[model samples]
Target: MGRKRTIKRDTVLDAAEQVVMRDGAARLTLDAVACEAGISKASVLYDYKTKQALIKAVVERRLAAHATCEQEVAASFSGDPDAAIRTRIEVASHLLTEEDRAVALGLLASLAQDADLREPIARTYGERIAQVTGHSRSPRGALLAFLAIEGLMSLEWLGLHDWAPEERARIIAEIGWLVDQVPAPVSAPASVLSSSPERSTR
Candidate 1:
């Protein structure tokens, strides 16, 4: 028979996130987390089969969190596409704030060298872009908007960015305004109909 546990898997992942975020991915080890969590190595293994499994799980958790954030942004839109774009900017700005990006940065560092990780990351950003661009003009415009947002975010996450605090504030403000500037498609009826059938007939 196998031993059963009570603690949530996120607890383990959250602990793992703290370790990776604070220390860096190089120090992420099963033994270290078990020690940090006050659990045995076997217990951690029960939750995650391997290091990659753990890291992948961390990514899964982030995706799930982002999904929740997406839903929240959708709610802000209330079926209004223009408002939805603004909400998207708000979500992006919110995600870029202090400590919020830590998990993202840590996970990025963990998979920075893997080609296999590209698909999941791309898909994740793709989903976000689709949400925002469902209201955009041409398909190309939406795609470009998605790319721009992702590039800025990637720069911030990689610590490869060198913007001052005020610069970051400016960027956020500029992006918010830029996304809002994209005009929504104007929908109209296909046929030009007669103004008054009875009047015309008479």
Candidate 2:
């Protein structure tokens, strides 16, 4: 008997991603994936029972990559409360490329058809929101920085704005400044302090 060839799961996922990028998610089919992967339909199906399962796998892969990026960035600023959220903005500002923007577009298209496909992504965002808000005393400032980063990414993704590298860097730097703008500490009124219960006892 001949030995059976084993196809790597990543290979299948890569093929599927390419399919989505090229033809949109609606065009993703087992036969198309197999053709893209240069494998038999049965081979692809062996790995993913249905199209939905394969798409979910793709989403999961992206989520794993995102988590790793967050961890790596967070590690750089160990013990710094603001580092957790700030580093995420820093990393995205530096690392997001044109190819990543295209992949994001494809993911959005897929999500439009399968709203349920977003559960994992939603969970990730929820956790990230908590981490960001909890890590910074100035939660509103941190959130503003986060939103600014998202706006820049959207501009890039949409191809509506052509920002020079220097301009983009400057904008991101300004956002970091905004994030660090903690409110001035307020002192208790002198009258209230004099009338304190502890002071009354004295």
Candidate 3:
């Protein structure tokens, strides 16, 4: 009934991600993560009552990591939402480091296998999309921008950025133009996730 300690939660989650990425979620075992994390198996069980609980923690952890960056980008453009958005897009584009690509792959792979991940994953994106609203840019435009950004993440994660750099650049560049067509911007970005500065690069 009491709160689980933060260290235990993190240790278990860390172990879960390692297991999921290396062995796949279907084969995840509490003992495996516990051993990998150098903690007693009971420790993991203590934080996560069940295998499902452990998986959720892992998924949430990964989601938060990505969310942290987006929040950062959002924080950069405090007053101008369009400029903030442009900055957000630019920062996201810049964040595609090799390590990020790897982490993204793991997080994505886990999400695909765990249905529980669907809502949080969708919510993480939906919240971001919600930032841009109204008729100036139909739901479709916002959707397109979201998808384009996702695609860019995918390509960059796969080390295929050069495969379509120009195409990607143009699409991202067009985000600014689209922002102009839209009405007032979203509120001041609360964090740097809105204005991430080139985390991923060639």
Candidate 4:
């Protein structure tokens, strides 16, 4: 019974995504979703009480999936201090798809009208920034790389820029090179270390 309910909920969400993609976010009525899913309006309401609730659910679902992907990628680079930023770069550059961008456009439309809908995004970005900078060899470099990647992704997502595959690859390669150039922290000289007040006192 639990499994059936889960499947039905996913079906509803899928139909809702399609409605947003095919029509505009403005056209995403519960009736439209039900019609698209071939389910009853009551069934849609049972899952999502309002349009705002439904949009939030859709955004949350996507964000959850992205978080899972980040975890998996971070795990693969387990011991690396730069794992968080690197994982973000890998996903933004390679993993995301055109359909994902389209869905993002739909969600952005909804988000622009509702400040409440921005909460999840704000929280996710906050967590991601903390992760990316917390143990970085060079936090500034990591942040710069992160910002650049986000800019690239935003341009693509908003249809502001259409980069050729090769061009995009070249840009990502440059970002990677920049990350690699962030020098490791230099250890203090032996004489300087020996002169430290704490060490000398000890």
Q: Name the candidate that leads on TM-score.
A: 4
Give the clash count for each candidate: 0, 0, 20, 0
Model 2 Cα shift for residue 5 (angstroms): 7.6
Report lDDT per candidate.
0.68, 0.82, 0.65, 0.84
RMSD of each: 12.2, 9.6, 12.3, 9.4
Candidate 4, residue 182: lDDT:
65
Q: How accurate is candidate 4 locally (lDDT)?
A: 0.84
lDDT of 1 at 126: 73
Give lDDT tens digits, candidate 3, residues 1-202: 9965655577677677777767767667888888889988878877777777777776677778766776677677656544334545766566465544554565565567667767777886676666654322355455455566667667777666554667666777876455544335566565665456663343
Q: Worst 10-residue stretch by lDDT in candidate 4? A: 1-10
The most accurate candidate by lDDT is: 4
* TM-score per candidate, chains pooled: 0.72, 0.82, 0.68, 0.83
Off by over 4 Å in 4: 1-7, 180-202
What is the per-residue lDDT of model 1 for residues 1-202, given as tens digits with 9 covering 90 to 100?
7656776787788778887778766678988777777777887898898877787787777777877887787786675655545555566665466454676666665687765655576787676667666765444454555566667777877666747777766776776556545456664443434344643655
Ranking according to lDDT, highest score first: 4, 2, 1, 3
- Ranking 1 against 3 by TM-score, winner: 1
The residue-by-residue lDDT of candidate 4 on 1-202, one tens digit each, is 3534433778988998999888867889999999999988988998899999998999999999888988887787888888888888888777357778788888787899788999999999998889877877878788878888988988888878988888899998777665555656678899999898978975
